[model samples]
Target: MPIADLLDRFRPGASVYLPGATGESLALAQALAADPDRLRGVEVTSCLLPGMNGVDYAGLAPDARLTVFMLPAATRESFAQGRVRLLPLAYSAIARHIAAAAFDVAIAHVAPPDAGGRASFGIAADFSPIAWNAARQRIAIVNPHMPSMRRGSSIALAEADLVVELDGPLVEVAPARPDATARAIAGRVAALIPHGAAVQVGIGGAPAALWAALGDHRGLRLRSGLASEELLALADRGALASDGHVAGIAAGSEGFYRTLADRDLIRFADTRETHDAGRIGREERFFAANSALEVDLFGQVNLEWQGGRPVSGAGGAPDFAAAGIGSPGGRSITMLPATAKGGTISRIVARLSSPSVSLPRNLADVVVTEHGVADLRHASLDARAEALIAIADPTMRDVLAEQWRSLRTAMA
Candidate 1:
């Protein structure tokens, strides 16, 4: 009935399905944070996306153990302490895991009820529907500030056992201003995308520049896991179709959220709908432009692991990559800068030293960097290595070529 009661349930160590990313409810999180004892010995599970949700749940509850799909910076300390366990799952697989958990409570942040008595999942719809449906108890923070999403994303408010009314600012991603390098990389990606294509572009400076580069594109559809603020600019320029943009979640400034609600630009979809291969395959031109930490000579991608630990989850990238690569007329494009770590390290490596290969070489149709584009589709093994090395940072190219030769010699 009230948030006080909700906090009471949490203190007793109820298995909670507190969603992160755009589904995060700052109201409930603050309420629990206000009383540290409320979180003691609690077991929390979430798919807290890296770089999206920064709350340190284990820090708040000293005795609490957390289970997360991705390792965000906020949770790194806990992870290092063995208080957090990671599940390296795809976006669709994460939904399946949440369904199996049957958590005691599933708390969601939703738009206030409309005249039709339905509360929209609003800014976040990726995994909320699955959690809400599978949990033994349902709670919703009825946030007036949450965008009122229209379409199949709304749920009846009566379904939630506890409905807490809260009016406060939601979590947001600061708007990204693409730099010259990002713009150059995005320019190459823009040229590869045809007008009227459905694109799956993720967040960050490169994607923001991708939208700016497509300023003249018409009738484009955005089918991405998360919507960046750049969607507004595209919509303003008539580059994006009115009803063509859809995403599983929205991450941007609060002002962007308001404009999205006012313009009804993004239709939020569940993970099943957004990541469905069959659904994406049906789209005429499903070009997925995703970021990767590194790509080896064979074009294998590593998007998750860095150093010796997991920094991010695979999420929907694999789903969209496979779907886009398999799409009859669509191509899967992986975009990244030529270097990382302030230009000291090469993103194009001779071999993926990371223990994880988030995406296989088969899904790598094209690789784009500020330097140039590498079309690896239907290429031979030797040809693939040469093409990838050609696009590598000029200084690193020689080193990578030597490494590639070593690999080939070893293979022989």
Candidate 2:
């Protein structure tokens, strides 16, 4: 069918759901944005918009609104300008939210059908399955460049109501190269992981460094929201367990996607399975490593706000952190540099100035900085504060300690 013809199907006031990350249909979204008349008053919802197509949300017709679950660099400006709606939901709850909202249309990028007429959801499978099941209209942009996978990660052609076939490259994200600080934090985090552990790694320099530092570990398994090149390298090196890895999405260079093509070593499941706390808790020696913008004396983690403004969403950090911490013989680790802004600002503070709390103190097991690690798993309020302040940047440790003491005195 013609791509323009498909745009005609959208009705005013309709709710449209699109997958985020690399699963977004670039050509289809561009076509939709180009014809504002067809999309007038339509509500388009998606997460982690990479902004590869250069679609201007503010330029879209006045009635159309773009709702984003996770704020990306491309949409940050628009969000600040009040041109986009931001919904803060963890990756695990996205499917439920979409289903409850009863979106009318689902647009997804998928691989071409195989001999069995099944198409893979490709690099992203986070909420697509749920969106497809809940939406009244199912539309797919079939891209030959996408890799086809096994049963659990694919959808049948019979499910799609409209199909627009286009051959193009899937979106790719270059891995964050770790620096000296990240490497130091990664070393401390790596030391905490046990052999034959199931790991969940979040996105950022610290997690990337941790993945790179785990080459020597044996029988590691991945249960994560997003898989990067480092995860591929581990599997290639025979360091991962033979049981295969579990992921909700894959966001890496083209080489990483090719590695996943028709391979059974990694199984792409929906967020429901990948982010389920109960399921993750069942894994032996589960370890989750996440990055944070700030950690306060009370052990609260802030991953979203910067300078008192919303910068990102919670994503899967909370789910994985709590699950990993609750699992038997498991641990949740948060890593970040002790300081920012040329060491002028400390990331470990006596109080969080931001409104968004990614993880509460109770869920925090370990906090790691380039300077050292703070084990808060079984610490009292005063002990937690002391441990955290001790691992802060040397220049700011005394200042944080004084602030903590003042806060304690005031409470008393």
Q: Pick the candidate with the highest TM-score.
A: 1
- For each of the candidates, give the backbone clash count: 0, 0
TM-score for each predicted model, relative to the true structure: 0.97, 0.96
Quote the lDDT for 379 in model 1.
Answer: 94
lDDT of 1 by residue, 1-412 (tens): 6678878778566888887897888877788778878888888997788777888887787788889988899999999998898988888788778878898988888998999789998888988888899899998888888988776387788888888888878888887888999999999999999988999997668888998899899989988888888888888898987676789888888888888888887788888888887779777889999888899999999988888678887878888988887787899888889999889999999889799799998877899999999999899999999999999999999999899889999998
Worst 10 residues of 2 by lDDT: 50-59
lDDT of 2 by residue, 1-412 (tens): 7777678777788888877787867666677666767777778888764433345553477667788876777776667677788888887787678767778888777888888888889778888887887888888878888887663477788888988897766778888899999999999999999889999988888899998889888999888888887887777777789875888888887777877764666788888889898789877789999999999999999998899877678888888987888889999899999999999999999999897688888887899999999999999999999999989999999999899989999998
TM-score of model number 2: 0.96
Clashes of 2: 0
Task: Give the per-residue Cα lDDT of candidate 2 at 241.
Answer: 90
